[model samples]
Target: MQPVQMTPAERAALERLVEHARGDTGQSRRVADFLLAWWNAGQCGSYDLTTAWGVDDTIMDDMCVVFRLASRANSYPETLGCGPQFEAIVRAWRPKLVE
Candidate 1:
């Protein structure tokens, strides 16, 4: 299926997430990059990539770590709440990233 388009709000939220991710430590940044790449590929509902990357099978908990890292990077109280928005942005940006 074709990816859905993102609204302006979603775009803004993704920018915020990226900004937050930028401040993460090395390991956390690796996790964030993997999440972003996976999300961008329209693969948010599974942990296959995480497992392949040697991430713990408990991906939800791993995502929480990413969220915490992002929060620390950006001082955004709302950072942890950005998962849905990030997913949307990833879907929207997938074609561009792939090309």
Candidate 2:
């Protein structure tokens, strides 16, 4: 499949997300850290947030919220997360299941 062509704004947003997600600090940093650690550990299967990340459902939900906002930011510029960049990070660290 061909790659999606991102606008300047979208590209900028993606870069920002990559920076923050992989940064040394920030709320979403944990998400990136977990992803990296799990992937590096050869556990690239489905992620049961509560069991895998050792957090409760509430924290899992919050993490999902952060991911969703980042994924959907292209449609809603005011959102505080990265759009396609977040997707790229996830794809790199934890690819989706094949149906």
Candidate 3:
């Protein structure tokens, strides 16, 4: 049997995401920002957010959901949330200290 995609469930998820992004001090906001940055980087960037959070499966899953919903929004964070949570998203791009 072919699998069916539930539109109602997705809509509910988007609504929840909307509420989550409304608050900045949450993983959803960071993930949204990270995903947007990845898209802006041609969707081929290798920042690997998974490693940033020590391969947290929940975060990776949220990333997928955010992408799925945002891709359908006309403005996404540009106007939806006023702006992105972070100015940019990078992996281990910080300066290292020398002993």
Candidate 4:
């Protein structure tokens, strides 16, 4: 499937998340690339992500890592769990595509 075109808000949110992941540039870039690919691919489901990203059954964990890293970078309170936080962001930025 062709990737969905992102809205300006979604694009900005993604860029902000990438910026927050301020660790190794290479690793950050890899994650960012993965995210962009994922989003473009019409917000593929977990199964698709697992197969495409080679994440095996630990796709949720990987998502947690991304969320945690992003939260840390942005200094958001760690109250919200990774999945919830990610979903919230996705909803806010791309409600139509996420569902």
As for candidate 1, its clashing pairs are none
User: For candidate 2, what's the RMSD?
Assistant: 9.7
Better of 1 and 3 by lDDT: 1
Each model's lDDT: 0.46, 0.45, 0.44, 0.42
Clashes, model 4 = 1
1-99 per-residue lDDT for model 3 (tens digits) = 323343564545544544443454646445444554543445424345553373246555555665565565534344444233322222212112111
User: Candidate 1, residues 3-66: lDDT per residue as tens digits?
Assistant: 3344454445455445444453544344455556534325433334443354344543545545
User: Residue 12 of model 4: what lDDT?
Assistant: 51
Q: Which stretches of candidate 3 lie over 4 Å from their true place?
A: 1-33, 42-54, 82-84, 88-99
lDDT of 2 at 81: 37
**lDDT digits (tens) for residues 1-99 of candidate 2:** 323345555455444445555544433555555444323335434434444354445545545554454354434322333345544555644556212
Clashing pairs in 4: 3-40
Clashes of each: 0, 0, 0, 1
TM-score, candidate 2, is 0.32
Q: Top model by TM-score, which number? A: 3
Report the poorest 10 consecutive residues by lDDT, candidate 3.
Answer: 90-99
Q: How many backbone clashes does candidate 2 have?
A: 0
Q: What is the lDDT of residue 68 in candidate 4?
A: 46
Q: How close is candidate 3 to the true structure, as a TM-score?
A: 0.38
Estimated TM-score for each candidate: 0.29, 0.32, 0.38, 0.25
Decreasing lDDT order of the candidates:
1, 2, 3, 4
